[model samples]
Structure formats: structure tokens, C-alpha cells
Target chain A: MTKSNEYTDSSRATVNRRSFLKGSGAVAAATALHSPAVEAEPQAAANVVSGATTITLNVNGGDHKVTVEPRTTLLEALRSQLELTGAKPVSSDGSSGASTVLVDGKPVMASTTLAMAVTGKNIETVESLGGEDTDAVPRAFVKHDAQQCGFCTPGFVVAVRALLNKNPDATESQIRQGLNGNICRCGTYNNIIKAALDVVKGGV
Target chain B: MKNFEYAAPCSENEVLQLLSDQSGQTELLAGGTDLVGLMKKMIVTPDRVVNIMEVPTLKNIEAVDGGGVAIGATVTLDEILAHPYLEDYPAITDAILGINSMQLQSQGTLGGEILQRPRCWFYRNGQELLDTGQISGGDNRFHAIFGNNGRSKFVQSSRIAPALCVLAAEARVIGPSDSDIQMIPLLDLFRTPRQEGQREHTLLPNQLVTHLVLPPVNGGLNATYEVRQGAGPEFPLASAAVSLELDNQQRVHQARVVLGQVAPTPWSSAAAADALMGQPLDAQAAETAGLAAVEEATPLSHNGYKVQLAQVAVKRAILRAAGLETGGL
Candidate 1:
């Protein structure tokens, strides 16, 4: 098994699943409430952020400890630090929506969100969608051939799950609008629409 | 993106003190939707980043003593849509709905939306803000037509600015010190920067927007209409917002018409409003107001198409506010 400190490629993560140290927990409370548990010292208030700080990020119901500076994006923390490379970094402007993840069940672009800002929130990523067998959404994608280059597949799957999770009986137009953030540059939109519509009809 | 220090200050005093004390550029990270992209592109490289997301007081959305509502600065766009009084403010809702991206609506904040930098193609792709030569000659179809000149031609990218301007919203600002606080009109917040150091907004380095007080509509009708190229995640080429009240005789009494995304700021069209005053709400009135709104518009070399789009947006917005069929797609 690869060491915990070392970067473990996700392709080998499934084989060594038991060796993983962190698992998702309910440890982080409402940290953003009115009296902060961690107070800013009066003297160090001005230069509080001197360098990299270690913080716990709850991703996919697992709390993984990682050291990150202010510049580290949530997408970086997931793909680089934890080696959950499911979310693709296709665009920095976040218009592609390939790096989308759910923060407290609301879909947000992981590339746009700072790792420091999303400390205690429950983050759900593409890795959390199901096991190696694939879920109904992925099955629908395969049945409809929703992907061309397969670069935008994982993001579309996660976004579709979040959309369905929020609204079970979403209309065909609603599905189209909700998943507009995720773009298929290869123009596999027709198939993707078919897959999303199939899922909306609850026929896997 | 350049590495920087991060501080999630506990109280408002600490936030202001840190802003005042930071010798270098300290950019406030509220929603991190816009600023993060700017930082990644090296458009704005702040030496220090103060995470204001965890600031407790800035998260509350409450109704004031009067019929108006005071929404906190950091409140997300999705939160605003879920508000109880959202139905009454169709102008604001329509503006927010124009931002079709769910991720953007979920993560973007109200304060950050108002202060968005120009999304000019030339400016964003490693050029100066006022580089008009590139805009005049290059792929300038998306460039501003209403406020274009030899200088800055980039349009204000905020979709919410026109809606708020029509509503006559008030902005509450606080910074540098705990006692430092002031309220100003939302329209007064923006300006077309003329110099190297001036910004598109009037806020100083240390000033922070705390909240916005949206005045009660008070039996007023308002709506927003935008002309877009696609239904997907695309910026509007031209948009308009109209707020008006009818007199006892069913004539337009008071009116405010503001155009969006076709100027440096929310272009308040007094001529359009004047065209509606003491006039009936009909297709002719809407057409007259639409024409009047575009009278001062000076479309650039490649953006003449935007003039017709802006005129139609104004007419549709005016008709939509009056609950009439706009006859527009």
C-alpha cells in the first residue's frame, strides 16, 4: 500500500481502498456561526495569515487533512492533495463547469471556490457518485453515449445527480438549464440531453 | 495564481483593522467566485486575501422596519431567489435568472456581483482597461455600443446593477474603523474610470460593502429583459430594466428606465422614462420609449447590432413591467 503522506493515484485507490486513512465524518459543526470557536488574537490580527495552514476539508463524506495556502483552490485540494482526480480542471474561468462539486448539496464550481473558504462544509464530489459498478446516472450516460472525449463525463454525472437530488421530478427543460454549466466541447450535447432526459423520466 | 496569506477574521473590527494594516494590496474574498478567476489570470494579484465568508453578521437576510428588505452582502444569488419577497421584485428576480449558470448562482454573492470588472475580450486577454484601439479594430461585437468612445469601451458586466438601480437600492458601506459607516445610492457606487489608478467603482482600498437596503416597491411594477445569443451560460449583449407606477387615470406616473451590459455603468435612461410619463401603456408608447433610450447610444465599429437589441430590450422590459405581452422571444 502506498504511504499516506505520498500521492496515491486514484486508479490504484480502489485496489487499496482499505489502506485509506481518512473517512467522512460529522466532525465539522456550524463553524460559521456568531461566536467563532477559533478567535483571532488581538496582536496577530493584522498579519494572521503568514504562510500555509493545515485545515480539515470534508470531501465526499471523508475528512482529509491537507496543508494549503490561500491560493489553493478546492479543485486542487481534491485532485492534487487527496488524489480524487474525478473533477477535471478544463477551464479556470469555471464556465466549463468541469470542476463542479456540491457544497452543502448546492452545486458550486470547485475551481472558483478557495480551499480556505470551504473549511467546514460538507463537500460532495464526483468520486462520491457510486462505486465501480456505476449508478443509474452513469448507466444512462453509457446507454445514451452522452460523452465524446469523456473529459466532461464525470462532471456531467455529478451535476445531474445534484440536479435530481434537488428536484426529483425535474422537467426536460429544467434538466437542460440545470446542467448548462457543464459543457461538452466535442458537441455531445444531444446524447447528454437524451441521457439527462432519460434519468428525469426515472428510466435507467 | 500567486501564493498569498489567508485570514478569516472573526469580527468586523478585525476585518477593518486588517484591511487598514495590510501594507500591500489586500483583496477581500467574500464569495471567491469572481476574485479567484481574476487572481488565476493575474488580473488582480493581491498580497493578502481576507476571507470574509465566515463573518457572521454579513450572512443575515432580514426585512427592515419598513416594507423594504436589507439583504446582507455575502448572501448568495440562490439565497436571494429563495427569499419570501422575491415574487414582489420581478425585476431583481429576472436579472438574477438571466445568470443561467447554477454554479455561478449558487456561489456568487450580491456584493461581488455589483463590483464585477468589465468582461471585455481585449481587457481580459492581457491588455490595459482603456485599450480602445484593439476594441475598435478587433473582434468587437461584444463591446459596448451605448457608452463607447475612443477611451474605455468595455461594458459593465453586472446583470444585477440595472435592476438595483431601477429599484433605487441603497448600499451600506463600512471599513477602516468600526465607527466608519455610510449609506449611498447603489447607482452612485459605479463610475467610468478615467485614470491609471482609478477603479470602475468609487470605493477606496479599505472600504467594504456590508449590505444593501432594497426599498419597498410600494405598488410599483418593475421587470427586466435581456437580449441573448443563446440559452446556455452566456452574457447578455443588451438588457433593460424598467420600474414604473400608474396614476389613478391609468397613466404612467413615475418611471425609471436603466439599460445594462451596454455601457460602463448602468445607463439610466431618463429620456425613456420621460417618454412614458403621462402616457398610456401601449405598443406605440413602448416603441417611443425604446427609441428614446437609444438616442444617445453611439455604437462602436462592430457593435451597431447592439443598438437594435438594446432598443428591443427596453421596449420588452417596459411592456413586461406593465404585465403586457412583450411580443418578444
Candidate 2:
């Protein structure tokens, strides 16, 4: 589709690495404080409902309440219900890993996880990274043209962001192991690695 | 995936009650990595999925009373990989590192990793359990080489099962009632599923695996080595986990060797362990032990190469455990 780097000079863009991390860290702390209050007194049978039930999902620092069938996966709910199509649903098995997302600051295969399982958990998708965070991973991805077909880019960006959040100083081998869950059919692994290293060095 | 009832219980009592009522119809969901894939494949369509991820007690890795470590059932593989205490258990760390993909390790739990369904493509296909026997054995390359004498040929595909077996880990199980708790040796956890109704492990329908306890590794050198088709994620063609207790002169005082992806269970090799006993873990001893590890292997037509691969894996694991050279040897 002739994709090009749209956001140049991302280092001077909206949020630098330090401020971005500080903002997210504040948000994470506030969320942690509010979590215990959200479920102080656990309900008895109210927690064990049958059939298609209404549930609350905390996604992207916001509360998303959706009524879904019990079999609905997080990937299905995000794409079909919430219309968050940034995370691609490549394979139902999740081995392709085009449905990668951050669950409580960890990279989880959303397609393989049930939506009901992540009731109070924080879910961050590629769509959630555009604000004050100004995630450098996506910019680095564009800088290197790490993706060709682009179907796998969102998942890679989210996966790389999660990896860098945990291990900003990840080595080359660690970087390869960290992002091994996501796949690129276009064989852009070397470029992807380069872009991730850029983000790690430039501070994501 | 088929529409089903879902429940996330907060306490152990709620979990046991739901499991007791549902029995065989309920599928306990941990990290949902394997269970969701099985559901998508229509292999297991449970009436209800009990989400046990929130169960407070099952998500810990702590030190037991002894010098051993107790890993809770819900601990993720990524947590285990990043754990500071894992450095002492090279067999475990190396075994988990051989898993290839970070996504599987991150999303997958210790309980889910060990209890994962077989990776046999034929088994995971849309064939019904009863109809699985109708296959007249076409392209049995990925099938079992050690446990193929029975109707089933699927090999267990766990990265940590063999390592846990060699380390003499034990599983603490909690049943429908608190009084029903039982401790089982890790090696006894697997058996050949001869019939459609039989599962790979002996856990009862109402029972839940709580923790895995590994005794203190006292002055033993251990490691896991695997042979795979590629650097990306593929089931190991053959793998070995070896633990050796050396005497003052570096002679093998005791050895525990286990092979994975070669049998219906984590195949423990007394012959290989015996071969290493009283012998220095040199190249000759490693080679002899490797050959002895596969002495009983009856390979399928296409999987005969797995025996040689398994031999190399055993040799490499032995060498790696002993802190010696492995590539040229």
C-alpha cells in the first residue's frame, strides 16, 4: 500500500520518553489504587453468572462495559464489540500473534484469552498509545519500514512496547526472544529488530 | 468457540464447588493459551469455563520449608524465566528457554504448560475422539516413537515435564473437598491415553493441580537440550533433561535422565542414568548414555531420525550440565 513514515523527528514530538513514562506510571498507580475499591466485597452468585452476561473491562485507562457471550475472546470482543480493529485477528489459535495486546503491562495473546477472564485487568492496544505517551516504538517502526504488508505491524508495535517497558536495556538476543511471539510473513524480522533497538536506545 | 457459561471465582471453595458440579463438563481456565486454542479447534467444548486466574492462592513462587522451591500452578512461564531463583535450576531455566517463543511463555502458565494437549497435528484436527482410532496411520512422522504400540501415537509435548521429572518434583493436588488433597510424584502424572475417554494425566475430574514442589538441588549439575527444526517455535523433535551428581573426583555418583516428545510420557531412562553412574561424564560416557536412553525406542517410518536427534540431545544436555564443550563433541 506504499506506506511511508508520516511522523518524522519523533524525538521532538508531543511526549518525550521521560514524560511519557511518568504519565503512564502515574496512571498505573492510580489504577492500582482504584482496583481494590472496585471489588472490595466479592459477590457470591452474582460473580458466577451463566449465559451471555454483561461485564466491565478496563481498557486503555478507561472502563468499557460490554455484553458478550461467555465464549467471546478478548480479541473478538475488542474487534467486534468495541470496534478496536488495530489488533488484527489473523489466526484463532493466536500462534500468528497478530492479536497482541498489553494486559496489565505484559504482552498477552488476546485472541487466546477470554474476555471474561480479563474483567478488571488493564488492556492496552495500539489504539491506546497515541496520546501523551507518544510511543516511540511505532515511530521507530515507521522510521525503519519494519513492516511491508502492515498486517503484523500493530501487534509488533504493541509487543515491542511491552518488551521495552519491562526491559529497556534488552540485548539483541533478549529483543529477539521478547518479540518472538509475533510473526511477520513479509520477512521483516531484521528490520523489526532494528526498529525495536532504536526505541530501546531512544527511550520508549 | 462454542458459547458457554463463564465464571471467575475468588476463593478455593467457589472453584471446587463449580468444578464438583460440572465435573467432566467444566474446563478450568488458567492463562487460556492452550485451552482457547483447543476450544477454537473444537477439541474440547466445555459447558462452562471456570476462570481460575483470579484465584489468589495459585499464583505464587515461594520457598518451601526445605531448600526446595514451590511453584504455584498459575505462575506464568515468563515469570519463571525472569525469576531470580531460577539460576540455581539450570535444568528448569534451560528447559523453559528451549520453548522458542516468548508469547507462549508469557501467556502460558506452569499448570497449562505441563497439562497442555498433545501437539500431534492429526489429534488436534477436527476428528472426534471416538473417530480418532479410524485413521489407518498415514504420515505418522510426528507421532510417537516410544509409545506407539497402543492405539494412540501422540507424544507429550511439554518443555518442563521432563525437567521436572528428572528433578524429582511433586504435584500437590486439591480435589473437590479440602480433605481430598494428595501428593503425587511428578513422574506419575503422565500415562498413555489408550482410549478416547482417557486423558494424558490421572487428575480426577473434580481435582485441581495446586503446586509443584522441587526439592533442593544439592551439588548437582543439570541442563536441558533440545533439537528443533528451526529457531522459531516448533515442537521439539527430541529433547533430553539430564541431572548428574558428581563425586569428589567428578565421577557420576547418580544420574537422572528424561526424554521428551519421544513418548506418551516424560520417558525416564534408568539405563542411561545407570550408564553414567560411577563414570566420568566424558564424551564416551555421554555417548553411551545417549545410546542407552534410546535403546527401547521403536520409531515410526519417518521418525527414525528422532532417535539420532534424541541421542545428540542427550549428549549435549550431559555436556552442558557438566559445563563442558558441546558443539564439536
State the DockQ, from 0 to 1, for candidate 1.
Answer: 0.22
Per-residue lDDT for B109-162 in model 2, tens only?
999899998887777786633224543346667667786777767788898998
| Per-model TM-score on C-alpha atoms | 0.90, 0.89
Q: Over all chains combined, what TM-score does candidate 2 have?
A: 0.89
Looking at model 1 chain B, report the run of 10 residues with the lowest lDDT sum. Answer: B60-69
Instruction: List the DockQ of the predictions in order.
Output: 0.22, 0.22
Cα lDDT of model 1 by residue, B1-329, tens digit: 98877788766557776674433388888777788888999988778888878776677564443456667788999898877655678998898888988888989999889887789877777687885467777878888886666477889999998999999987877756555566779889998877544678888778778777777888889999989998988899999999999998989999999999898888999999999999988788889999999988898788889999999999999889888854544
How displaced is residue B258 in candidate 1, in Å? 0.6
lDDT of 1 by residue, A98-177 (tens): 99889999889899999988999999988787688667888899899888899988888888888888887888788888
Q: Which candidate ranks first by TM-score, i.e. highest? A: 1
Instruction: List candidate 2 segments past 4 Å from native.
Output: A1-46, A131-133, B20-23, B128-136
